[model samples]
Every structure is written in structure tokens, then in C-alpha cells.
Target: MRINVLQHTPNEGPGSIATWAELHGHALFTYHPYQFGQLPTAVETDMLIILGGPMSPNDDLPWIKAERVLIQDLLARDVPMFGACYGAQQITKALGYPVSKAPTKEVGWVPVYRQSSVIPNLPDNLNVLHWHEEMFEIPTEATWLFASAAVRNQGFVLNHRVVGLQFHVEPRQNNVREMVVNDFPYIKGSVLNQTAEDILRVTVSGKNERALFAILDYIIE
Candidate 1:
């Protein structure tokens, strides 16, 4: 299978997703729309993974708009897609739902509770990394998957093929370090936000990676 990834920043890449793809013998490709301004068409994408970013989906950038259009096209064709954070917001916006400011800027390791049993093997609650100021609204047709105390809409699943997570489940240790280093300024002194030292101090466990892989497998199945 040809798995295409849409990355918005250099810091945010397909961490464990790439590993999962390699283990499954699938080809993985990444496109940096922020830098190269190119995206894969639906025909070329067997599975689409949209990574997180610092930008908002409401931004008036040309590439953001183009990516939303591509998302809409892919949705029309029933292409399996997995979106993280900003990518999740983009998918919600593309589906004609609203993406608004979250109650608070959640940036750290937070616990998200599983609200639906659509995807198996997910624990009732898991501490996943989060870095977002805005949240995506669950579409009327989508099943509410997960929720955290800080954000009500932590994740959603649509059509049993598209999944959107408002947290960072694909980040490895190095990926988290890069995110903490590059987007350090975004982390403020909030009740939900964690300090750089604290975020870095916590080890990146294999549980999150397994959860991410499970979601990916569920989407493609």
C-alpha cells in the first residue's frame, strides 16, 4: 500500500507511523506543504496520514486551503485517513464542521478517556502528548472516540476509515524532543501545560505507539 503523509513542519514527522508502515511492508511518503507546496492526489494515496503543526486550520494560507480541498476530495473517494492535532482540525473544517479555540491551551502529557468502543484494544484512559490551542468539533456523522478534561473532543472516527486525534500519539522520544525544542515558546504556564523539563523528563512509552498503530490498522482494515 502507498501511504502518503502530509507534514506541516520539519519538527513534526511521521514518527512511529513510518515504523509501522515498514513493518507492514507498505511504502510511506511525506509531503511538506509548508515548504514545497505540493500534495498527493487521491488516486496516488492509498492511505493518508496528516501530522500536527503550529498553524491553525483557520489560517488564510493558500496551502492550508489547498490541503482542505484535497482532504475533501479524498473523503469523497472514501480514502482512509488519520489526522493528528492541526491535521484533525483541518479534517473537521473540510467536513464543514467548526474548529474553534479550545477552553485552554493544552500542551503536555494529558489523559484522554476513550468514549467509544469502535476501535478495539484502546485503554479506557491514556496519557498522550498534546499541543494545541484549538479543537475540532465532532461531526454529526462521526462517532466520538475520546475526550480529555481539558478538551471535550479529543478524537472522533468517521465512516470507520477516517480517524482524527487531537493529541500526539505518533511521537517518539526524539520527535517529542524536537517538538519541545522548536515549539517551546508556545508552552505557557497553564494548569494543563507542562514545563519543558517535565515534558522531556517523562519517557516516551511504547503504549502510545501501540495505540497509534492500532488506530492505523483499524483505519486501513
Candidate 2:
């Protein structure tokens, strides 16, 4: 299988997604528009993984606009897609859905609930990493999968292939640390936000990793 990852920032890279691809011996490619400022051509991707970033999909940035175009092309072909935080926002915008600022920011280890879906036996509550101030509505033709106290549209699946999550189920300790350092100012005092110390204390357990892999398996298989 071929997996193409679109990463918008230096700190935010494929975490468990890369691990799963390597273990499965699938071909993996990445395009960092922040550094290179060039998007990849829409090729035949068995799975398209869009990693999270701090940027908003509604930004006036040229690359963000270009990414929406690519996302539209992939949707038209019915290619399986997995989008993280910012990636989720992009997917929603591409589908003509609204992407707007949340009433409160969601950072650190937050909890999410899985809605009843084909993916079976998901726990009632899941603690996953989060670092976003924006939120997206579930797109048309997509089934709502997850929700949180702060955001109702935490995750959704479109055509049973394209999945988007507003939180991070893939980031390891290193990834979280990098995000805390690079985007420290976002860690303001809030009911939903947590301190750096609290964020570091949150463990990357096997449960969350397994949930992420389960989603990936569903997407690629």
C-alpha cells in the first residue's frame, strides 16, 4: 500500500501512523509545505494521512488553499484519508463545511467519546492528546464518530474511508514535548487547556495507540 502524508509544520509529523506503515511494510511519502512550500500531485494513494498543525484551514496562506484543492481531488476519487486536528479542519473546509474557532481551546490530554459505528467495541471514554483552538462541523455524507465536552464534532467518517479526528491519537512523548516547546504560548490558562507539566505527565498508553491503529487498519484495508 502507498501512504502519502501531508504535514504542515516541522514539529507535527506522523507519529504512530509512520510506525504502523513501517511495520506493515507499506510505501510512505511526506510533503512538508512549511519548509518546501510545494504540494504533491494527487497520485494513487492507498491511504492519505494529513498530520495536525497549529495553522487554521481558514487562513489566507497559499499552501492552505492549495491543500484544500488537493483534498477535493482525493475526495472525488474516494481515496481513504485520515486527518488529524488541522487536517480535520482542512477536510471540512474542502467539503464546504464550516470551520470556526471553538468557544475554548483544547490542549493536553483530553477525553473523547466514541459514537456508535462500524468500528466495534470502542471505549466509552478515551484520553488522547490535543492541541487545537479551532473546530470543524461534520461534513455532508460523513457519519459522526466521536465527540468531547468542548467540541461536538471530534471525529467523523465519510464513505467509511475518510476519517478525521480533532485530537492526536498518534503522538508519543517526543512529539508532545516538541509541540510544547515550539508552541508554548498556546498553553494559556483555560478550563480545557492544561499546563506543560500536566501535558508531560500524560502517558502515551497502548490503548490509545491501538485505537489509532484500528482506525488506520480500517482506512487502508
Candidate 3:
């Protein structure tokens, strides 16, 4: 399968998704919307993986508008899509759903609970990176898949084809540390409420990455 990746930044590129794509023999391609690029003309892709970003879904960015249309068209055509954080918000918003500031910004490794779905076949609580200020509404046509203790709407699936996850299931440790160094400035005001030491403790739980990829693999399958 050819998996197209819509990247929002350089560091938060593909992470485990790239790993999985390579190991599984799926051809990988990328579109950096931050650079105002076009979606691939190739339709050979079996899945579309939209990565996370620092920008909110409501941002007036040009790529945001273009990708919104692209995602909607993909969904309409019944193509498989899996979005993370901002990507998930974009999916929900494109479907006429709403996204807004979450009361508590989930930052470190937090457990996401499975709702009424086959996801319960996995662990009861899998720790994930929560780095978004905005949350998405479960599309009226979608079914809730998972939730976290801090946030109720962690993820949802529409017609079992499109899946959106609010948490970062595939975070690379170095990229996260770098994010804390560079992108941290933008989230500093609200993120500072939690100590850097505490964030480190939770995020460094390396075992979470396995479960994260497992979930992603399951979702894509």
C-alpha cells in the first residue's frame, strides 16, 4: 500500500508510522502543507495519514483550507484516513464538526480509554502524548472509539474508514524534547503550569510507543 503523509513540521514527521510503513513494504510519500504544497496527484495510496501540527484547526492558513477540502473529498470517496492531534481536528472540522480549546491541555503521557468499540481489545489505558489546545466534536455520523481521563473525546471513527485520534500515539522522544525546546515557547503560558520535570517523567515512559504503534496498525488495518 502507498501511504501518503501530510506533515505539519519537520521533527514531528512520520516517527513510528514511517517505521511501520517501511517494515510493512508500503511506499511512503509526504506533503508538507506548511510550505503550501499540492496534494499528490497519485491515487495509488491505500491510506492517508495526516500528521499533527502546532496550528489550530480554525487558523486562517491557506493549507488548512486546501487540506480541509482534500480531506473531505477523500472521506467522501471512502478512502482510509488516520489523523493525529491537529490532523484529527481538521478531519472533524471538514465534516462540519466543531473544535475548541480543551479546558485542560493534555501534555504528557496520559491514558486513553476505549469507548464502545473494538479498541477495547487492546490495553485498558494506553499512555499517549497530549499536546493540543483544541478538541474535536464526534461527528454526528461517527462512532466514538476512545477517550482519556482528562479528555472525553480522544478519538472517533466514521463508517470504519476514517479514524481521528486527539493524542499523539507515535511521538519520538528526541522530537518531543526538541518540541519542548523550540515549540514549547508557544505553549509555555499554559504548559508551564506543569513542571518540566513532571512532563519528562511521563513522556520518558518508552514502553508506551509499542502500544501506540499497535493501535495505529490496528486502526489502519
TM-score of each: 0.98, 0.95, 0.88
Q: Pick the candidate with the highest lDDT.
A: 1
Compose the digit string of candidate 1's lDDT tens values, residues 80-193: 999999999999999998899889888999889999999999888888899888999999999999999978999999998999999989999999999999988888955575
Give the alpha carbon lDDT tens digit for every residue of 35-144 in model 2.
78877677866678888987788889988998889899998887889999999889999999989988777888878999856675467678998888889998768888
Candidate 3 lDDT over residue span 115-181, tens digit each:
7655434566666777877899998888887898667899887876788889887767776676666
Provide the overall lDDT of each model, using Cα atoms, as 2-decimal numbers.
Answer: 0.92, 0.85, 0.76
Best of the candidates, TM-score: 1
Q: On a 0 to 1 TM-score scale, where does candidate 1 land against the true structure?
A: 0.98
**Where does candidate 2 have its weakest 10-residue lDDT segment?**
116-125
CA displacement after TM-score superposition, residue 95 of candidate 3 (Å): 0.8
Question: What TM-score, to 2 decimals, does candidate 3 have?
Answer: 0.88
Model 3 stretches with alpha carbons more than 4 Å out: 42-44, 187-192, 203-207
Over 4 Å off, model 2: none
Q: What CA RMSD would you report for each candidate?
A: 0.9, 1.4, 2.3
